[model samples]
Target: MIIPAIDLIGGKVVRLFQGDYAQKTEYSASPQDRFDLYVSEGARYLHLVDLDGARDPAARQLETIASLIKNTPVPVEIGGGIRSRKDVEDLLNIGADRVVIGSCAVKNPTEVKEWFRDYGASHIVLALDINIDPVSGKRFIAVKGWQENSGVTIEDLIADYREAGLRYVLCTDISKDGTLKGTNVALYTDLHREFPDISFIASGGIGSLDDVRNTAQSGAFGVVLGRALLEGKFTVKEALECWPNA
Candidate 1:
């Protein structure tokens, strides 16, 4: 699947230079503009994240994002600041194809399961942001919109959520997101090979067309494009050239 990212912060759609909220660039005149740009690129699915929504679960840009979803031909999968069943319901009811559970999956594992039970695996996703501390031999999920660690390991998180009936998962390397540093392929490849049944998605550090090719070959069903796509590192059409059948 080919997906483009629409990361919203403070109600404005922006792209982080490297997950550095401060070094980001605003690319759209409006949310709808960004949506249209992606649609023009032949994208049929979008990865949406409300950066502000992640900081405060109450900071809802749902209506703004929902409005874009209605106008865009691509279906949307949203994350960032989803806390409750109501949050998930509101997004889905408003036109979100899938409601992503990020920090909440770590904060409330049982709730993640309940959501999957209620919405089914396809409509619910768990976004796991992995930050590896190599020297300490530790890995944790960066929570609160990648500002803090949730103290969860990638392996453990995937294992737990899969038991909760989660088949779709989005994984990002906080250190690499928006960096154009290339994707953390070894990690994703291992995870995908381990959980062969789940639809694993890689979501950061894709710099060039080869990155897109590597990601698809790594077994990630989809990869989200942001900086690279905007900077003309590769066209959505070019990325699709390397993507295997659907």
Candidate 2:
């Protein structure tokens, strides 16, 4: 599936470059307008991230999220600041098809395990944003909207959640995120080889139709297009056409 992203910052649609909050670029379009646009383009799924909620634990964008869900025909999966059972329940109650657990999952794996079992693997998705050491090339997880390093490796977290029955995992290379440089194909390909059972959603650094094709060829279950789609680099129709078998 080709998931169009609507990243929210202060109730406005925005995109951050390489996960740097200071380097954010806000679009003039409203969230509802973007939702309508994606729906019109034949998008089956939408990816919504709460930039505010990720940084503020007390943040709640339920009103905006609810409006998008009520207005759009396609299912939307939300992430950021979802830290508790209530957060998951509230999002689900408000019609979120799935909630991506990020910082909280990394902080407390045991509690997240219970959530996976309770909410069912399909309803709960894990967002693993990573930073690769420049020299050693070792990947480590980044949390709290990619503001802090968790010191946990992607491999370790995947191993921890493997038995939790997680069906979906969204992996984003923090360096490539919002850069439109291209996805880290080697990372995802290696992940697929190691955990072939889990459906991985490739996020970050998608610049054009060719990038989407490369991601699909690398065995990603789906791709999350943020800046590329918003910047008019490629139309959703074109992307979907490139991966007809996706």
Candidate 3:
């Protein structure tokens, strides 16, 4: 599936270069307009991130997100600054199909696992941002809006969650994110092969239709389109066409 993504900062649609807040670009389109546009263009699912909430949970834009969810007909998954059960509950209560847990999941795996049990695996999605060491070729998980390295390997984290019935995982390659270069096909390919039961959603560096094709062929269940879609590099319909049976 070609899942369209909208990153929000102060209720405005925006995108950050490599997850850096200082290097941000805000789009003129409102979140509602962008959502409607994606729906019109054949997007089946949507990903929303609250940049404000990501930096500070207390500043979460719940009212704005709730309004968007109330209007969206398709499944919408929301993330950013989701650190507590109340945060997850608030999103789900407001009609979010899935609540994506990132830094909290890394900081408190036990607590997150309980959430999967309480909410069911289908209702919870784990967002793991990865940083690869250029010299050692090791992948480490980054948390807190990609500001802190958790010092935990992706393999270990997923393995731990697999026991708790983990269903969906959104994995992003920080190096390629917002760069418009290409996706980390090899990473998703290896992950898909290793954890065939989990639905892995590949994110970051989706620049062209061919990137979508490669991701689909990599066995990823879905791909999140951000900058490429926002910049009109291609439409959601064109991206879906590149994936067989999407």
lDDT of each residue in 91-163, candidate 3, tens digit only: 9998999999998888999999999999999999999999998998788999867888899988899999999
Better of 1 and 2 by TM-score: 2
Estimate the Cα RMSD of every predicted model relative to the unseen true structure: 1.7, 1.2, 0.9
Cα lDDT tens digits, model 2, 14-120, are 98887778988999999999888888988999999988887775787888889889889989999978898888998999999999998788999999999998989
- The best candidate in terms of lDDT: 3
Give me the runs in candidate 2 sitting further than 4 Å from their true place: none
lDDT ranking from best to worst?
A: 3, 2, 1
- Superposed Cα RMSD, model 3: 0.9
Predicted candidate 1 versus true structure: per-residue lDDT over 1-246, tens digit per residue: 888887888778788665667787887567777678778878888888888877777888877887788788878888878998888888989989998888888989887798888888889888888888989756688876677887788788888877777788888888788779899988778888888988888888999888888888898889888778777788777888889985
What is the Å distance of residue 1 in model 2 from its true position? 1.3
Predicted structure 1: lDDT: 0.82
**Per-candidate TM-score against the hidden true structure:** 0.93, 0.96, 0.98
lDDT of 1 at 215: 89
Candidate 1, residue 213: lDDT: 84
**Preferred candidate (TM-score higher): 1 or 3:** 3
Q: Evaluated with TM-score, which candidate comes out highest? A: 3
What is the overall TM-score of model 3 with all chains considered together?
0.98
Selected candidate, larger TM-score, 2 vs 3: 3
Off by over 4 Å in 1: 136-138
